[model samples]
Target: MPRRSEAKSGAGSAVRFFVYRSPMKKPNTSPAKATGRCALEWIRPEIRALRAYHVPEGQDLVKLDAMENPYPWPEGLVEKWLDTLRESAINRYPEPSPEALKGLLRKTMRIPDGMGVLLGNGSDELIQLIAMSMQGSRRDKPRVILAPEPTFVMYRLIAMACGLEFVGAPLRAADFSLDGGTVLDAIEKHQPAVVFLAYPNNPTGNLFDTELLLAILAQAPGLVVIDEAYTPFAQTSRMEWLRDWPNLIILRTLSKLGFAGLRLGFAVGHPEWMEEMNKLRLPYNINTLTQASLSLALDHFSVFEEQITRIRQDREKLFRALSAREGVTAWPSRANFILFRPAGKSADAIHAGLREQGVLIKNLHGNHPLLENCLRVTVGTPEENQAFLEALGIVGVK
Candidate 1:
């Protein structure tokens, strides 16, 4: 140990700062002796009980596991985009409130007038913010996040991460449609702080009835989030209904529309609610590059619109093909993917067989009891879908 020395600018005519000029000792780099410290012991048990979200490797495969736009940017779009990025202020922080980009989104997504939009790094971050905003808001009871079972997993995962109670009401076993009575009952019981319903629901690929959703919205005691991540393919929205439901907000993302890399997701709702969410949002959460790139892409929004149109057509064709197959039963979908079950094979066997044939898709056999023996495939380019259909036949799923 050594005492500090004084350092002054220009030989001590100024107020000086105290500085330590003592000889420095080499720090110990040896391995620590065990003191019985365990990170799991310190971490929240809810978190400890959860598994990290896993994305299966689809490298060098016709990746249809995740519903992504199968086409790359049209010719010359990439060059035009690079020129725009070159002009962005990379050294400066992005807008704390990105008004121009929000304007572009409002126009592009047809966001209703007078509604406020809050952007997030992605849909997951937006969900986290929604959960955090309601966390600990109730003093007498545990705050809850609710959704239908066999829908999106993030609603529950995010709820757990935020220390809120998660409740999932089951969908009907016959088709993945929401049982309004069951959901209404769950909402009445849980009185969730937020209820997340994925329009054109995930994995199962069927949209819940509109009346059922409105009924749930009417019964819900707190905020309702309609996640329209697949709206481009679904071609329907609840955004217009925002004028009617004060407790409602809708979530949309550019991921399925071919900007997944940019990681932008926005929520449109009343200013009162948006103001509270904006408080928890990290400054510059949407980076300069993302904001610029998405704004420019919206200018060429027609390119995605065309691709979406083609994908919608391909979805029906794929659905018909799966339906025509002798051993498979495919559910109808408003989204760009189809969920089907194979009569003579297990989902694991079929999924692996597709992978071996250089194709990839989701296998949801054990994710829930209702999803048993079920598999989901995204509508891809003609060649990719053909490859998958062929793979399915080869694997005896036909």
Candidate 2:
């Protein structure tokens, strides 16, 4: 496709130029329209086949689908935060390096000494940066990204978006723990450029075994990323592992810590790796508002930490409730969400029934073979949790 731009010469005469990029076939249709034949010619079939990541509409619903913190700031804290935002300079671009925020995050997250920080709009962006940094990034022989099946969807989505092949090493069928044998075998065969292990992985909500993870680090031939997005609930971290493994990087996000609106996530690792990934990060990628809000929020970290403690307690209670229910097989979780399966009911039917009763949660049927009949609900306020439990009982659960 050709992009038109105007430039000025030394004499100030206007100059027009057309830049043509490859991978796009010229279309017979004119540039006036962007659909129909034009889209067919320019869009990759791989992209066309992919479904855009969708967030289900939850207007007027109880809303527990996404793994997000359910509580808001206290009224007094809200006022103080508003003041911070009001004083922030939105007119100027944010610090591209975000040195102060990095220092604060290091203290808050307890990242090991000597590791550097690389910030992202969210962990999703950092994941993309890692994928883009792989050798032959823009498709010479398509680099490969490997991860255990039924983990976070972004690793696969970002890999394909960067013109790389994604390989899923199957997880243990009974539980969603890492299948060590299969993973090691796949790593040897694929020689993936990036291997992602989501600690307390998504959808299944179980932490992979530490011993198996270390084994993977030993066997993997390329970069190894530990995605600890749920560390706020799990209360364990692999930060110390970075001191030992040169190829290791740990990814975290404030989204799970009652600050999802800020859109801040970061990577902690050896300086050599962060220096390379930093090159692909867009200039001023994080806006001033986010930087200001996160700084203020971190100072009031105890407020969120208290909320996390309550959520952790409630998560156990909710787990017990699901486990005691006759038809539900609830898996224990170290994340804010619980994964369960219905014994004698259709997962879709149960999900739809809950929505009709003004409750919204994830329905994981058919997403992967291991996730069949599974649904995930985030731990909410006590009242909301009761609403979900009663709603589940009203649905097909015995």
Candidate 3:
């Protein structure tokens, strides 16, 4: 009964409704989808399940966990460093061998004669290079690395990254001292290929017995890495002993010597061993700017010496202050930081209280078996140290 125009209009309306029901879209099959599928199937097993290391955030607060030097270079010396950088050829790649920096380091650091120098972005990179060189070359033997627990974590982490087995021996709980007898026993059992000993241990801030360290060096079947990152504060070194022990590699850094921003660290060891390690080193690990700046800083070593002296003095003051406090057990420290256990109060609560007061220190509770209820405070300037002591009083025994 409808006219032809009305019927045609009804058909057009039906077609519009069908089009609206199914909205159009581009194809869902994309390059990103294919790439994601490939990644899930082809990623290495070790990396897929890996957990990254946790470094504390909050640098605006008192940063004591990383053990960085709190002082900056004096203004005049900094000006001199700037002048040197102005002349640097930054557009050109840094020297492959970093000869000028090495020469200055050798003279300034008083590196032992005949020992070769190997530079790293930080000591962390050097550790990786050592592990890779050892593992890559010696595939037949079961590659083993040993480190005393409560020492540096990087040694074990690096070894694991290289797919080498890591053995961790425990320190004596009575004083956190090295148990030479136990270490020797472990060496015999495992016949480890690399051993790491942090001279002034972190989170504890106490130096191990040197006599025992020497004893371990004598018996170990493979390379021994002595991490002396805090050597500037301690002022005692075994660099002279490099002449006698070819297996020894002494690691030092400017991080604690007022140049942490530069991230410069080096290893001194027998030339033959370092030669092999150097072959595996990346060509331009040290940047041009860093090399230039470090060379200038080394030329003015007296500034660094003065700053280190102040830190050492401050450390003693902090130690005495911590010892005099009621119920706190502070251990003797040769490094620029002190480690103590809070008495009658929970370390976690004390750490939180300090955080609220805008003063942050390390809380070592449950980090290791021996470090329970312990906290580490880096020796800041006199004013900072006083402020920290005052903050402790506010949070007392609560």
Candidate 4:
């Protein structure tokens, strides 16, 4: 007994329902309209042109690409660490200022009294913090970040992220070493707001000349950040230079000290610079668990020291083994890793062949002009090192 209009409307409802029920049906559309949108549309254009940092996947394999310590903490020490963490109040927020961790770090690191320590999730975060603090109020001047190529990629990545200009000077080709004159020239030309020099440069695995570093630090117009992530292996640090150059900041981490899982890195510098960086740092940036675990681990430094010593010894053995082999040129390294070039054969072939054999190492063939046909290997346990050496023998450079 429905009226004709009601019947028509019911039919329309049924049609709509049918359309909804049909998975293949497309929505009806009106003419495309350019409506109100964010004024920051240009941000997308900028981002699209930027290359993101690619972290390698090596968790399942031998897991050596990241230069992490290949050993775990002593079982007893680990248990004690866990017991210490048992009382942590994870339900509540951690202290905004991790004073205890800082104190422990100062004591453990033997940090100078006037210097301040800033903790980072990793040294990467500290790099970002340095960039943020230096960039400050100037979007127009185009803050400059100066670093040598074939070094840490984060310096350039972070600079690009902050919309700052990055100037990468190539390392000396013969040895992949820092060229002080060239670096000083770049500093003079660019007037960079920040300069980063990775002590014991990555991928090349050689420490920069100390005298040259001091000269560059003296000449640099802006802050000089010396990333000493591999200091444990080298057993040398510029920490004492804090008083000599207020513009100097030294970065260190537990990653190479057998606690990559904890993700603890610290930057040591004058308190004034640290104060500015602290202001921009997120409250409770480091979680309670990490701080507690790192504190416990620091208390037992001998355990970590023994592991590092073993790695250094293993590194020497690996270097000697590679050097004796034909068709591969091994570079000297102060780090727990080695960088070598395949003399007659393509590094790619060796890398792929090793991977096929269940061995993994970084193939740095085309990354840079200096790194052509280069492969970097982390120093592993005696057994692991022997395995890698045997794999190399099978692949045999040429």
- Can you write out model 3's per-residue Cα lDDT over 48-85, one digit (the tens) per residue? 66557777786678666567778877889878888988
Ranking 1 against 4 by lDDT, winner:
1
Of candidate 2, the 10-residue stretch with the lowest lDDT total is 135-144
Clashing pairs in 1: none
Cα lDDT for residue 56, candidate 2: 93
TM-score of 1: 0.90
Which is the winner by lDDT between candidate 1 and candidate 2? Answer: 2
* lDDT by residue for model 4 (71-115), tens: 887889978988989999999898788888889889988898889
How many pairs collide in each candidate, listed in order? 0, 0, 0, 0
Clashing pairs in 3: none
Tell me how far candidate 2 lies from the true structure as C-alpha RMSD in angstroms: 8.3
Computed on alpha carbons, the lDDT of every model, listed in order, comes to 0.90, 0.91, 0.84, 0.84
- Order the candidate numbers by TM-score, best to worst: 2, 1, 4, 3
lDDT, residue 3, candidate 4: 25
Colliding pairs, model 4? none
Better of 1 and 3 by TM-score: 1
Better of 2 and 3 by lDDT: 2
